[model samples]
Target: MTILENIRGPRDLKVLDEAELDELAEDIREFLIHAVAGTGGHLGPNLGVVELSIALHRVFDSPADRILWDTGHQSYVHKLLTGRQDFSKLRGKGGLSGYPSREESAHDVIENSHASTVLGWADGLAKAHQVLGRDDHVVAVIGDGALTGGMAWEALNNIAAAEDRPLTIVVNDNERSYAPTIGGLAGHLAALRTTDGYERLLAWGKDVLQHTPVIGQPLYGSLHGAKKGFKDTFAPQGMFEDLGLKYVGPVDGHDIAAVESALRRAKRFHGPVLVHCITEKGRGYRHAEQDEADRFHTVGRMAPRTCEPSEPSIGPSWTSVFGDEIAAIGAERPDVVAITAAMLHTVGLTKFAARFPDRVWDVGIAEQHAAVSAAGLATGGLHPVVAVYATFLNRAFDQLLMDVALHRCGVTFVLDRAGVTGVDGPSHNGMWDMSLLQVVPGLRIAAPRDADQLRAQLREAVEVTDAPTVLRFPKEAVGRPQPALDRVGGMDVLHRSDDAGVLLISVGALAPVCLQAAELLEGRGLGCTVVDPRWVKPVDEQLAPLAAAHRVVAVVEDNSRTGGVGSAVGQALRDAGVDVPLRTFGIPEQFLAHGKRGEVLADIGLTPVEIAGRISAALVRVRTKSREEYGR
Candidate 1:
C-alpha cells in the first residue's frame, strides 16, 4: 500500500518517517493529477502545497487547533491528509467540494472560499480562544496573492495589536493567485524569496553577539533595537516586526523538513508569527509549469499527459462574445478603458487588453480597490468598464454603492458568471447579484438574453454618462438568438398569443426556457405572452401595462427568488396598481450544491417543465379565488 493510503487522518501523518513522508507527497501528487484530471478543480495551488500541507498536518492537531485556509482552493491537499480520498465526483453533487466545507469534515473550520478572509477568521478564533481560556492554536495559511487585499492588512493590524495572541500566519508564497500577484506587496514577497542575505546576517549577528562577555548581551540588545533599521537597509521584511509580530524564515515550501522546522518554531513562539515559505505554483506537473498565463490555476476535465480539454466546446462562450465586442469598442472609443480584479482573461478582457495595452488595468485580487479606482477613472473623464465575476463583486458592495453609484459615475460593470454557475459550489454561484444590487439607487442592471443582446446592452451600458450601469451574463455558452416578434418599449416580446392570459418575463439567458414554459402553458389552454426584458433593472416601465392586460404574470430568472428580477417586477406591478396574480420562478434563497448547471437548475425547480407546472397551478388558484370573491 502507498504511504498516502495509510494517512486516514492527521494522526496518521505524525507516524510517518522522512522517507515515508517523501513517498506520501509523491503518492498524493500522482493521486491529485489523476483525480483532478477526471474531475476538474484547482490543480496548481494544491500541487504546490503538498509538502506544506503534510508538514502542517504533522505539526498541528486540527479540529482542536484550527488550521484555516484562505480562499480554500488550496485545501485539496488538506482534504487528502484528513482522509478524503474519494475524488470520483469531486466538485460534483454528492461528492467532495472544491473548497473547504464544514459539512464534509470537523477539521474544515471556515467554508468561505473568498480570498483574504482567513487572517480575519484566525484573529477572531484567537480572540475567542483567549476569552474562553482555551489553549487551542490558530494557524492561517494565506497565499501571497491574498495579501494584496485590504482585509488581510486589516486583520494583520488587529492580530499585531494583540501581542499576546497565539496566531501563526503561514504565507504560502507561490507568487500567484489566479494569475501572477500584482502591487507592491507581491514585489516585496518576490524580494524576500530571492534575497535572504540580510536575514542570514541578522542570524549570524545574534549568535556571535550573544555568546560574548557581559558587554555581549547589551550589544545584542542594542542591535535588536536597530534591527528594523538594518532590515530596512537590506531585507525590508521588518514590516512584520514593526507591527509587533515575530518574523520567521523565507523557508523552502517544497522541503517538508524545512517547512516542518519553520512551523515548529512558529508554534513555539507565544505571539503572532509569520513564516514565509517559497514554492512554485505548478511544481510537480510539467504542463502546469509551462502554462505562463495562470500556471494552470483552474482547469476543466483534461488529459493528464497533454493537459488538453477532454471534450470540445459546444458553442462560443459568453466571455468570448464580450471579449470581441469590448476589443471593437476599445478601437473606436479612446476614452473607454478597462479594469479587472486580477482576472483579466477570466472576465473576457484579454482581447481588450491586447488591443489597447495602455488602456487596461489589472488591480490585483482587490475588488474594493477595483470599484473605487473605476470611480476615480470615471472622474478623470474616462469611462472604465470594470469586468469581474459576479460573485466576487460582493466583496466591493460598499465601494460600488458609495464611490461609484453615489457619485453617479459612468463606470460600466460587466459581470460574467452572473447566474447559477454550478460545479464550483455555493460561494462561487452568482445568484445574489440581482437581489443585492436592487437597493443601489442610480444603478441600472442589464441581463442580456443572447450574444446579440449582450453586445447591444454592453454598448448601451457604456453610453450611459451619468448613473452606473451593470451588464450581467451567465457562465454557459451563448445560445441561439430568439428574435422578438414585437418590441414593447425596451422589452422584447418573444412570444405573443392571440388571447394572452400569462405574461412570461424572461431575464437574461433564461429566455429560451421561459419561451418553452410559455408553449407548455399554451398547450394546457392557458394562452401566454413571453417577453424578454433585455435590461432587467430599473424594472422596465412597459412591464406594468403589459402585465395588467394578462390574468397571471410570471418572472423567470437565474438569480435568487427572494430579491431577484421577479421581486423587482412584483414591486413595480404593485406600485402601478396592476393587481395581476404574479408568480416568481427562480433559484431559492439557499446555498446551491455543486453539480452540472442543468442538474442544479433541475434540482432547484428552475427547469421549463417545473416553471410551467407552477405557473399553471397558480393560474387555477387565481381563477378559483376570483369566482369566490365575485360570488359568480
Candidate 2:
C-alpha cells in the first residue's frame, strides 16, 4: 500500500520516517492532481504547502491546539492529513467544500473564506485560552498576500502587545495572492528574504574583533551596548523584535525537516513568535509554474497531463463583455480610470489596464482601501470604476456607505460574479450585494438582463457624476441578447399578454428564466406580462402603475429575497397604495452549498417550473380572498 493510503490522521504522520514522509508527500500530490483535475478547485496553493502542512500536523496537535488557516483555500493539504481525502464530489452538491467547514470535521476551526481574517481570529482564540487558563497553543498560518490588508496589522498590534500570550504565526510566503502582492509590505518582505540573521552578524563581530589589537576588548564592550543599533544597521530584524515578538528563520518551506525544526522552536517560545517560510506558489506542477497571470491559483476541470480545460468554452462570459466596453469607455473619456483589489484579471479589468496603463490601480487584497481610495479619486475630478467580485464588496460596506455614499461621490462599482457563483461555495457566491446595498441612501443599483444591457447600463452608471452607482452581473456566460418589444419608463417590456394578470419583473441574468416561467404560466391559461427593470434599485416609478393593471405581481432575482429587488418593488407598491397581491421569488436567506449553478438554483426553487407552480398557487389563494371580501 502507498504511504498515504495507510495514513488515517495526524498520528499516522507522526510515526512516518523521513523517507516515508517524502513518499507520502508525493502520493498526496498525485492524489490532488488527479482528484482536483476532475472536480476543479484551488490547485496551486495546496500544491505549494504539502511539506509545510505535513510539518505542521506533526508538530502541533490540532482540535486541542487550534491551527487556523487564513482564507481557507490553502487547507486542502490539511484536509488530506486529517483523514478526509474523499475527493470524488469535491465542491459539488452534498460534497466536500472547497474551503474548510466546521460541519465536516472538528479540526476545521473557522469557515470564512475571506482573506486577512485569520489573525484576528487567532488573537481572540488566544485571549480566550488565557482567560480560561488553558495550556493549548494558537497557530495562525497567514499568506504573504493577506498581510497587505489593514486587519492583519490591527491583529499584529494586539498580538505583539500581549507579551505573555502563546501564539505562533506562520507566514507562508508564496509571494502572490491572485496576482503578485503589491504595496510597501511586499517590498519589505522581499528585502527580508535576502538578508542574513542577527546571529550571523554577532558571530562576524566576534571573529573580526578577536583578530584586532588590545583595543578589541574595549571595543567589544561598546559594541555589546550598541548591539541593537548594529543589528538594525546590518540585519534589520528589528521589525518583529520592536513589536515585542520573537522572529525565527527565513526557512525553506519545502524542506520538511527545516520547517519542522523552526515550528518546534516557535512552540517552545512562550510569547508570540513568527516563523517565515519561503515556498513557491505552484512548486510541483510545470504548467502552473508557467502561468504568470495568477499562477493557476484556481482552476476548472482540466486534463492532468496537458493542463488544458476538459470542457470547451460555452460562450462569451459577462466579464469579457464588460472588459471590451470598459476599454472602449477609457479610450473616449480621458477622465475615466479603474481600480481593483488585487484582482485585475479576475474582474475583467485587463483590457482597460492595457489601454490606459496609468489610469488603472491595483490596491492589493484590500477592498476597504479600494473603496475609500476611489472616493478620493472621484472627489479629485476623476471617474473611478472600482471592479471587484460582488462577495468581496461586502468587506468595504462601511467605506462604501460612509465615504462614498455619504459624500455623494461618483464612484461606479462594477461587481463581477454578482449572484450565486455556485462552484466556489457560499462565501464566494455574490448573493448578498443587492440585499446589503438596499439601505445605502442615493445608491443606484443596475442588474442587467443580457450582454447588451450590461454594456448599456455600464455607460449609464459612469454618466452619474453625483451619487454612487453599481453595475452587477453574474458569473456565467452572457446568453443571446433578449431584446424588448417595448419600453416603459426605465423598464424593458420583454413579453406582454392580452389578459394581463401577472406582471413578472425580471432582474439581471434571471430574465431568460423569467421568460421561460412566463411561457409555462401562459400554457396553464394564465396570461402574464414580463418586464425587465434594467435598474432595480429605486423600484422604477413605472412599476407601481403596471402592478395596478395586473391582478398578481411577481418579481424574480438571483440575489437574496429578503432585501432584494422584489422587496424594493413591494415597498414601492405600498407607498403608491397599489394593493395587488405580490410574490417575491429569489434565493432564500441562508448559505447555499457548492454545486453546479443550475443544480443549486433548482435546489433553492429558483427554476422556471417551480416558480410558475408557486405563482399559480399564490394566484388561487388571492382569488379566494377576493371572493371572501365580496361576500363580506
Candidate 3:
C-alpha cells in the first residue's frame, strides 16, 4: 500500500518519519490530481493543502483538539487523512461532500462552506473548553482571502482581548480567492511574505546578545523593546502583534518540517497565536500553476493526462449569456457600474470588468460591503450591478434591505447560480434568494427563463431607477428561448389552452418543465395554461384575475416552497377575492444532499411528470371538496 493508503487516521501520520511524511504528501497530491480529475472537485486548493493538512493532523489531535477549516472546500486533504479516502464519487449523490461534513466524521466541524466563519467557531469552541476547564486546543485554518471579511476581524478582536485563550490561527496564505486576494490585507500579507530572513535575524540577535554577560541581558531587553520598530522595518506584522496575539512566522507552507515546527510552537503557546504560512495555489499540477485565471480553483470531470474536460460543452452557460450581454450593455450605458465580492469571473462579470475596469470593483469576500457599496454607487447617480452567487446575498440581506431598499437605491443585484446549484451541496445552492427577498418592499425580482429573457429582464432591472431590482438565473446551460404565446401584464403566457382548467405559474428555469407538465396534463384530459412571470416579486397584478378564470392554480419554482413566488401569488389571489385553490410546487424545506441538478429537482418533485401528477391530484381533491359542499 502507498503512504496515503496507510494514513487511515491522524494517529497513522504520527508514526511516519520525516522522509516518509514528505513521501506521503507527494502521494496525497498525486492521488488528488488523479481522483479529482475523475470526479471533478476543488483540484488546486486540495493540492496546495496536502502538506499543510498532513502537518496539521500530525500536530493537533483533531476531534479532541478541534481543528476547524474555514470555508471547508480545503478540507478534502483533511478528510483523506481522517480515514475517508474514497474519492470515487466525490460531490456526487451518496458520496463525500465537497465541503466538510460532520455526518461523515467526528473530525469535521463547520460543515457549511461559507468563508471567514471558522474563526468565530474556534472562538466559541475555545471558550467552551475554557469554561469546562478542559485542555483541548482549538486551531482554525483560515485563508488570507477569508481574512478580508469583517466577521473574521470581529472574531479576532474578541479572541485578542482574551489573552489566555488557547487558540491557534493558521493563516493559509495562498494569495488568491477565485482571483488574487485584493485590498489592504493582501498588501499586508505581501509585505510579510517578502521579509525572508526577519525571523533568523531576531533569533541571531537574541542568541548573540544574551550570551555576552550582565550588559547582554539588558541589551537584549532593549532590542526586544525596540523589536516592534525593527520588525516594522522588515516584516511589518505589528497589526497582529499590536492586537495582543502572538504572531509566528511567514513560514513556507509547502515545507512540511517548517509548517509542523510553526504549528508545534503555536500548540505550545497559552494565548491566541497566529501562524502565517505562505504557499502557492496549484503547487504540484503544471497546467493548474501555468493557468493565469483561478489556477483551476474548481474543475469539471476531466482527463488527468491532458487536463481537459471529459465531456464537451453543451452550449453557452447562463453565466456566459449574462457575461456577454452585460459587457455589451456596459458599452452603451457609461453610467452602469458593476461590483462583485471576490467572484468576478464566477458571477459573469469578467467581460464587464475587462471592458469597464474603472467602473467595476472586486470588493474582496465581503458581501455586506458589496451591497452597501452598491447603495453608495447608486446614490452617486450611477446604477450599480452587484453580481454574486445568490446564496452569498443572504449575508448582505440587511444591507440590501436597509441600505439599498430603504434609501430607494437604483442598484441591480445580478444573482448567478440562482436556483438549486446541486453539486456543492446545501450551502452553495442559491435556493433561498426569492424567499428572502420577497419581503423587501419596492424590490423587484426577475426570474429569467432563457437567454433572451435573461438579457431582456436584466435590461429592465437596470432601467428601474427608483427601486432595487434583482435578476436571478441558474448555474446550468441557458436553454432555448421559450416564446410567449401572449402577455398578461408583466408575465409571459407560455402555453394557453382554449378550455383551460389548471393555471400553471412557472418561475425562471422551470418554464420548460411547466410547459412539459401542461402537455402531460392535456393527455390526462386536464387542459392547462402555463404562465411565466418574468418578474416574480410583487406578483404581476393580472395574475389574480387570470387565476380566477381557471379551476385551480399551481405555481412551480426552483426555490423553497415557503415565501417564494408561489406564496406571493397565493397572497395576491387571496387579496383580490379570487379564492382559487392553489398548490405550490417547489423544493421542500430541507437541506438537499449533493447530486446533479436534474436528479435533485426530480427527487423534490420538480420534474414535468411529477408536477403533472401532483396538479392532477390537486384538481381531483378540489372537485371532491366542491361536491361535498354542494351536498351540504
TM-score between candidate 3 and the true structure: 0.93
**Candidate 1 local lDDT, 508-566, one digit each (tens):** 99998998998898899999999998888898888898999989999999999998889
Report lDDT (CA) for all predictions.
0.89, 0.89, 0.89
Question: What stretches of model 1 exceed 4 Å from their correct place?
Answer: 176-225, 229-236, 629-631
* 211: Cα error in model 2, Å: 34
Residues 108-131, model 2: lDDT tens digits: 998878999999999999999999
Name the lDDT of candidate 3: 0.89
Per model, state how many residue pairs clash. 0, 0, 0
- In model 3, the worst 10-residue window by lDDT is 176-185
Tell me the TM-score of each prediction against the true structure: 0.92, 0.92, 0.93
Cα lDDT tens digits for candidate 3, 262-354: 788778767788988887888899999997898889999999989878988898999999999999999999999999998999988888888
Best of the two (2, 3) by TM-score = 3
